[model samples]
Target: MSDANNQTKAAPKHSAMHIAVGLLARRDYSRQQIQLKLQQKQYDADEIETTLDHCQQSGYLDDARFAALLLKSHISKGHGVNKIRQSMQQKGLSRALIEQVLLDSECDWFEVAKLKAQKKYGEAVPLDHPTRAKCIRYLMGQGFDYEQANYALAVEVD
Candidate 1:
């Protein structure tokens, strides 16, 4: 019948709040990330805004908390501040939030670079020019600045 066919073709309707909550149940999401997801689901702008407000009001969504957790996770994985900032930006976190979380973090980037270098290369600093350059490039790729990369290459690993 046409009625049965129409019913089958119709997508199951879910409120924006319900969809957002379902997503949050799986993992933490930034407000912007949630907005993008809702937009992708074809939610109206007003409905998306209301859902976002409610989620924030209920403490189910907190950008600050998400930023902190993201920073901590990146640091634990031996990522540098630059890499962490890039990741946060890609995740739609605001610059101010990213800076605040990074500022609040107690990670010693120098030490992290050193450890990462040590873990990858070994206790000894690279001596040959080409090998040293390679090591510096590797550290830089991992988001360490030139100074930090040089320090990682020059310092004696203990």
Candidate 2:
């Protein structure tokens, strides 16, 4: 059993389209992400590019749709816009696609901040300076800017 486990074997080669399809069947992927994954699997550059173009043409890959889904999922997790934007950028989404997703989302940052703050600190504003600063810091850590964090911390109960 030990000898069998230590045996060396070659990775079976797969066609680029086959690998790309298998990957897409598992989950949505941006074209660049898929290209990188195929590259890691040792696919040829020309094959990877050709397969990617075919997938895009056939609607199996869409960066815009991927971006939208990513944005929605992140927003639902209470993340701020800046954080979501950074995440998308890291995922290799273009600026135009990212901006389009944000514009289409039409989220109210202040309202989301207020809701998130309430979930954490309740409806009342923090009484002391340290606690107040902590609240602000927490929101900022969640990818909010100073203005948004302050607004979240300043929310008052009706």
> Model 1 TM-score?
0.93
Candidates in order: C-alpha RMSD to true structure: 1.7, 3.5
Query: What is the C-alpha local distance difference test score of each model?
Result: 0.90, 0.88
Q: Distance (Å) between predicted and true CA of 153, model 2? A: 1.6
Q: Model 2: how far is 64 from its true place, Å? A: 0.4
lDDT of each residue in 1-158, candidate 1, tens digit only: 99999999999989999999999988899999999999999999999999999999999999998998898788778888888999999999999989989888978899999989999998888799999999988888888888888888785546
lDDT tens digits by residue: candidate 2, 1-158? 76666564545578999999999999999888999999998888999999999999999999999999998898887889899999999899999999999999999887787778889888788879999999999998787888988888874557
Assess every candidate by TM-score: 0.93, 0.89
Number of clashes recorded per candidate: 0, 0
Which ten-residue region of model 2 has the weakest summed lDDT?
Answer: 3-12
Model 2, TM vs. native: 0.89
lDDT score of residue 151 within candidate 1: 82
